[model samples]
Target: MITDSENMKQTNANIAEYTVSEISGALKRTVEDRFGYVRVRAELSGVKRVSSGHCYFALKDESSVLDGVMWRGNVSRLSFVPEDGLEVVCSGKLTTYAARSKYQMVVDAMEPAGAGALMALLEERKQKLASEGLFDPSRKVPIPFLPRKIGVVTSPTGAVIRDILHRLSDRFPSNVMVWPVLVQGEGAAEQVSQAIAGFNAMENGRPDLLIVARGGGSIEDLWSFNEEVVVRAVAASQIPLISAVGHETDTTLIDYAADLRAPTPTAAAEKAVPVKVDLEFSLTDLGRRLSVQKTKMLEDRKQAIVALARALPKPKDILGMNSQKLDDLSERLPMALLNSTRQKSILLGRLSGSLSSGKLQQAARFNRERLLSASSRLRPISARLLTEKKDRILVAARMLASLSYQNVLNRGFAMVKNDSGNIVKTHEGLKIGDKGEIVFASGSVAFETSSGMNEATANMPKRTSEKPRPKKPNKVNSKVDTNQGSLF
Candidate 1:
């Protein structure tokens, strides 16, 4: 806020100023109002042309000079070219150039300094175009014998159109395409050139020939037809063009560039088509002449045939041509077949040799040897695997043998059992007259337990009233309990 206030104060110290365009526009308005449409005569200087079709130059006298610019629209209307040293008259409003900050005259009208200037310019342009071969007669297109459609470049509202239509209607009466364009004044050359180009650009029933026509006029009225743009456009046209711009006395540059030149619009139409009655008569005559020529041609052909027959070979020789050809083919047939069969037989022999039994046997032997070699490599591994498995089996068998209870029996010991074949580890399970089995090393024996092995057979101990004490197992004692399954 403070900086803005400071700027405001600084701006207030100086008075308000106008932009460059604002001042220039004010000056322009003042000058145009004061010196409107003034005419000046001065020598042209520093004349330069730009691609935009505008020419910029200086209007100068001995003491001072003023800049001037003539746009394409105004430049095209001039009767003569503006040169650097040539004095000329110009008429337009004065205006200030904003960009350059200077004043200049926009020239809308220009003319030569003397009466001969126009002719000189016209001649100069003609020479230039001619030097570039624009007027070469060899480059001219031949007018078509019969054009299905004709295009005309002219004012649509003028009597020129009516006259052309009437003339063509009187003749062959073809389809006509009319291109409307301005023929004089500002932008006339542009419109005329564009109209010609438009006709050239059309397709699908495009014109066979074009006619650039206008009513009779003075050189200034017909000046558009002579512009470089219009002439070039006519020269570059794809369709054949006919120049009928003015009366017979008036000529234009387009007349030299067009394919055909006609003195008037009606004459151009007559040249573009033929009279219907005359064509019919000529066609009838042509038909009669053609029939006569055809008959004469047939007669001449008959005489030619007779003469050719006289020069031909004899009939016998002519009839034998095919037979001679057949004889030649017959002579070649057997050798050709024989050669083909020989080649096939050679191929068959070579194939048979390749498929012989010896070769098959060799292949089989090679496979068998490969199998043997593979088996030979695997033999040691298979044997080692078998040997190791057998050794494990033997070791397991030894372990199993050592774990067997029959080994104890093989030590000359027996396992005593009761009558149910239960092992009796103690003799208490057995009593006198009780039968039992004794397991030996290889067999078992059934035996009756008569008494203890070391005790009397008939002696027995009676029940006592006192508690008995445990005694040594080696001797039979009165307190021995014989109901136990252990033998100590």
Candidate 2:
């Protein structure tokens, strides 16, 4: 029984005899040592290479990623410095690091993630500068071709300074003043901005032109020139400016804001200076053309003077023309006077002949003869004819007096009329009881017809009922006949 109990105890102890480290070591070996290592590619991010020959960073992409490790040797061979935002294709093997107890990539090699990230960075910078109106063509200044003084703003230690100096010396050999500035750092943008502003503010006649420049670098390293403050300072500068930043493939905000943008620092310096040979040739051509123009102008003036002298009239010619006009008038005067005298003499002779013609002579003789006869016989003939006419007129007057109505009435002959007022000459026209008018030499009376004129002539006895009538004169003639006819 004792032997069996000891054996049981030994078996139990053996079954429970394992430590935590031992178990964990077995599990690690089983999980990690069996799988095949993988080589993957990703973009680099959060890159940090330490001095211990190890790099700790993330290899991530849009969908999935892992941590990465690069030994210092591999990192040193990179053509470009790795940064957080740089896209890089990494080749590495998947492995578990025992010390850190984490699965990570041990990278053997890296290359740029290709052109996509570079283009993306360029577009982002473009939009940033464009929003600030730095790319506006209107904001560009006019650079002086042959600047009197050129102001250079750049890193003192950079190759850009060397390039600019050499180009300027070669092209124009101009006087230049360099304003040193930090091209990369915390305050690098501000330093570049201040340098530009300082050159503009220089009291002793600011530089005729300015050149803001830098050498090629990575996007981050060249970012100072892309800053808004630097861009605005360049735009606000009074002097014309040239921007020489980075290589031709790289652009910054200063490029857009400057008056001129050169492909390189050397190009910017070339733009600032004029070629001495070209200027000298131009001056010579201008001088020759000016001399020809001066000669032509002198000839024009001489011709004008000669023309003016030819157009002027001489005094003697003017006097001779007037004298000829006077002589013509004098030669015609006597002929005009003689013609007028001849016309007057002819008119007088014609008038005298008309006065002595036969008709006029006959009229004169008749007037004289009639005048003498009238003077001798006019009084006696007139007196005789007047006496005879007066005697005849007296006889006719007496006959008219005897034939008038009053004279007939005085001789007792009265007129009577009928009822229609017609003269009643015979008694047959009378009507009994009709009223009638009887006219006397001096008066008239109306009577009712109770008696006739014939009765009046017949001397009828008065009727007792009739009105009384005056007695008519007895027609007894004694010696003289008083009734007479008219002498017309």
Q: Considering every candidate listed, which one attains the maximal TM-score?
A: 1
Model 1 lDDT tens row, 146-189:
89999999999999999999999998889999999987776788
Off by over 4 Å in 2: 1-115, 184-187, 217-221, 317-488
Report, for every candidate in turn, its global Cα lDDT versus the true structure: 0.79, 0.71
Weakest 10 consecutive residues, lDDT, candidate 2?
Answer: 479-488
Per-candidate TM vs. native?
A: 0.49, 0.44
Clashes of each: 4, 1
Candidate 1 whole-model C-alpha lDDT, 0 to 1: 0.79
Question: Who wins the lDDT comparison?
Answer: 1
RMSD of each: 47.6, 43.7
> Where does candidate 1 stray beyond 4 Å?
1-38, 43-57, 61-64, 69-87, 92-109, 288-488
Clashing pairs in 2: 141-259
For model 1, where is the 10-residue window of minimal lDDT?
475-484
